[model samples]
Target: MAPEVRTNVNLKPYRQALALPGLRPLLLVSVLARIPFTATSLALTFYVLLELERGYGAAGLVGAAMTVGAALGAPLLGRLVDRYGLRPVLALTTVAEAVFWSTAAVLPYPVLVGAAFLGGLLNLPLFSVIRQSIAAMAPPDQRRPAYALDSMSVELSFMIGPALAVALATSFSPHLTLYAVGAGIVGSGITLFLLNPPTRGSDEPTGPVGPPSRRAWLTPRLFGVLAVSTACTLVLGGTDVSVVAALRDGGEVRWTGLVLTVWAVASLVGGFAYGALTRPVPPWVLLAGLSLTTIPIGLGGGTWWLLCLALVPAGLLCAPTIAATADTVSRLAPVGARGEAMGLHGSAITVGVALGAPLAGAVIDHTVAGWGFAVTGLIGLLVALAVLPTELRRRRIAADHAAAERAAPEQTAGDDRKQSPTVGGPNGELVGTEH
Candidate 1:
């Protein structure tokens, strides 16, 4: 007899998801590919500062150029992927990125700045591809876990990537680190391309037919998901700034790194636990939890150890919120447009961090450091609460429209009966319809 497939509501989802054909390799390649992404900015900063002997302002400008490039590149590259398929896009980007970095190390400061911008613009949309693939391949029930796994991989990359860059740059030369980064990108990109993971099914479009509809895949629900993701990350950025400032104030600057690591670990653990469950928490609930938990963190500014404990609740919500947003995007985004959707999702995150840190820093400079955490938490909570009413109204309208559609056939049938001509006698029994 054939063996029966194992099943459990709690544990089976993740197991089954991993068991899906071609998923594991894709996941592995995705993680490896993204390591360079996390490493690049830090490495670039060090490179410009140390090797080129540029000032912080120049380094900052170069970094900003990269960020701008990434923001612009994502949607454009994603659209290309949707139109032309993954392999060609990945192939072109891989070649371009490899060449860009290889040449960047030898270029002058003026040229390096422009090169950085181009590199960012042409950076392979690895994260977008992976998320889109997971959304496409995983069963609907298994997606939460799949996305959660993806989020955890991202967390791990963040944990390792920057540190690795710093270690390599500090120990060896920054030029060597740049070369290593370029090599990593090329190697990972080639592996993923050759593996040829199933990004979309046969039904999905491989190329564009004509101009897209005016009301395209970016629906209101998807917009809401992106907005919530941005808000959550913004809060995270603010929290980071506050924690560092508070630690500095308490003369526990040395403990700041440890505290942040612990905070990230909490988020990683939360992602694992959230993914294991059969049911996942809603994005709004996670957002609320994140905001609520952060409020108490500001209260611990006097004691660094106390602040570490306060960070736990907010940190726990981090990965889950990210995972939940990914899941939401999967559900809300239309089939052919998922690549662009995922691209937009990543952009939202970058934008959030870009906005949050500076705004929070400004707040800290203007007021006390502790107020940064408080204001960040409050902003997140308020945003979530404010969006709730609009979301509710949209959902209600959708439900009414759906109900009307369901009732439409019956209403049409009834009207037809009322308008039908009667061939029978005075009893008013309708026997025939009008010719």
Candidate 2:
């Protein structure tokens, strides 16, 4: 006799999600990858300062290189994922990252920047792949928690990575810190490659391959979500530049790092503590509120205390909005298209940062630091208003579905008697739909 598959409909909700086999591996890989990704941000600046006698500008350039590469490369890598499976592609990317990150450890500033750019190119699709995997492997009700967990992991990396980099740079040298980061990324990548996350073993079946290409990305739903995400990120991206410039102006430039560090730490706290209670906030409204709240960033609270106070609310928006976007994407995307959906979402983030930085930097460099915040706030307002109608429509659809589900009968003796012959469930109940 064949072994009967286990079943447990009564499983505790939280426990049920935790039972998902692929979830932990996905989280592990995410945390590991982000270690180097975030730490490098801190280390690169020190590398420029120590070896090349370059200023913050070089560090800024390194940040731009990483963002630009990730933006350009995600879509292509995503397309490849649709054709090939994740394992080989992941292994190849990881190997390239390993090679480049190690080499970058000892290279001169120019060489290191070039290597960093290359590393960014090779690092494409990892985050999107993991997100797509989580969507495929987790149960429907469990998806929100999965995304929450993933967002939290990102926040964790942001919190710990720079701080760790600071400690290492203070104790050892920037080169040594870079070497350590390289080793960590390589080791983590190898682990992910070896364990191969469940997505490696088999392909998730996507019913009826969607459109011919990613042409559907321009569709209203995705485009709308992308717009909101980008707007939200612009607030974040622009705020970083504005704050840095303002600090520079106030002769508190050193505090720029500290303020950013504080912001990241607050974000970390918010992510871990975001429980199931926040589900009451509809995704669309949540996104708009998050974006709209960012308008305060432009407020010239010149004192450090006021600036710090302003950041907590601004920082709070970061993970929650991202989690909302992830939730929306998971529901809307077809199975195989998750990677592309996530890639596009990631691209929006990169584009926001890229656009926001230079635009704000120009204002600061030319006019004044404060205008940087105002310009980005306007962008945020535009994106939020543009996407509002769609968010409302989605909410209505969800409400109607919930109402339908509520009215459905759970069981009926008459219905049971009318069950058509064919398949039988494990409990010997008629499983086929009644004609």
Candidate 3:
């Protein structure tokens, strides 16, 4: 069936994107896969504190170890996907993750930390794979809407996954919840393996084998896209730290969760609105919007309500920034290297968070809570500016290269005709131009 085409982004296109063949299953499994990504940390924290009778300090360390493992693993797994195929890599990781989680449930505290790290390191790169699949499966024009929907789904997952994990852990047994989460991960992994979406080399190549080209996948344009994405996440991470600080300062630490929820809801709305626009906004513009909106959030120091209000404008830009960056990464990455590029994009996000949290906490410790927001926002703007020239130059070069390639075939055909003489008479006389 011919996929529906749209002149503008709207509700209809979003529906159409979902209805596309092969995409629905992918999206469904992707959401399932993401549950563990969002839920496991919360579940682990609870498991350590409640079941093992450990301190929050121990739980935090374990969680940090898991995150570090995932961060380190994402790019390597993506590179493997690019070099080999998706199914084998996913299958291996699926088995590893299931085994790790199962073992983790029974291990001692010290051993459990290491197991969690290994599990996270080998965690199925389902989210990265899904994002790459969307780029591969969706038509060019539909990608904007596709990415928007993708971003929205992630937000929904964040809202549901962590809360569900905590509730189940608190109401039931933490160990049981961890087992359940592991089972869900296994199911998601199996589903993805069965689906076996295509990567660059899924089919046999037509050309003869030779030395690989020295060209790299991390082109400057893609680097810019990744940078913008990292900056956006950095802002969010900093906001998280600053929000906690602000709430604690005001003695309303309990309201921190509520305030963040409000911020998240605003971002969800922004994703919908951004998706519906006829033209997607540029990455720089979205980043600028975020920085400008975020800068004032620090001024809302007195109460949680004021902080919530200040966050609304910045929150509105969050999903848009993410969606735009995803779309840009899809566009910038070559077909052969899409998996690795997307993996790097995912890595950029994790790195941003890893750095932003510590940076913001340091700032807050040295100065006041509000400066965390101010400092992060200013840094984001500076990063946007720093990459502007390089991004512009890369864009121009890419456009020129594309233009040359487009004209090459015509030029080659003309030269071939010029070299071969055409017969002008019945005697097969060669006709040559005198001019």
Best by TM-score: 1
- Model 2 worst lDDT run, 10 consecutive residues: 199-208
In order, candidate lDDTs are: 0.83, 0.71, 0.82
Better of 1 and 2 by TM-score: 1
Clashing pairs in 1: none
| C-alpha TM-scores of all predictions | 0.87, 0.77, 0.83
Candidate 2 Cα errors over 4 Å, as ranges:
1-16, 105-115, 200-212, 216-218, 246-262, 265-275, 278-284, 298-300, 366-370, 390-435
Each candidate: how many clashes? 0, 0, 0
> For candidate 3, lDDT tens digit of each residue in 374-399?
98898889888877898678769899
Which segments of model 1 are wrong by more than 4 Å?
1-9, 202-211, 401-435
lDDT of 3 at 241: 91
| Candidate 3 runs further than 4 Å off | 1-9, 200-214, 395-435
Winner by lDDT: 1
lDDT of 2 by residue, 1-435 (tens): 999998644324445556788777678778877877678777877877876678888888886787777787776676566557667778878788778767776677777677777777777366677777777777557776677678878877777787888899889998888788877777766776776654322455633344355565446888887777677677777888888887777777767767887677766555544434435344455556655655665565445556677778767767767776776776776655666677788788778767887887887777777788777777777777777788678779999999877666544555767877778789988667777
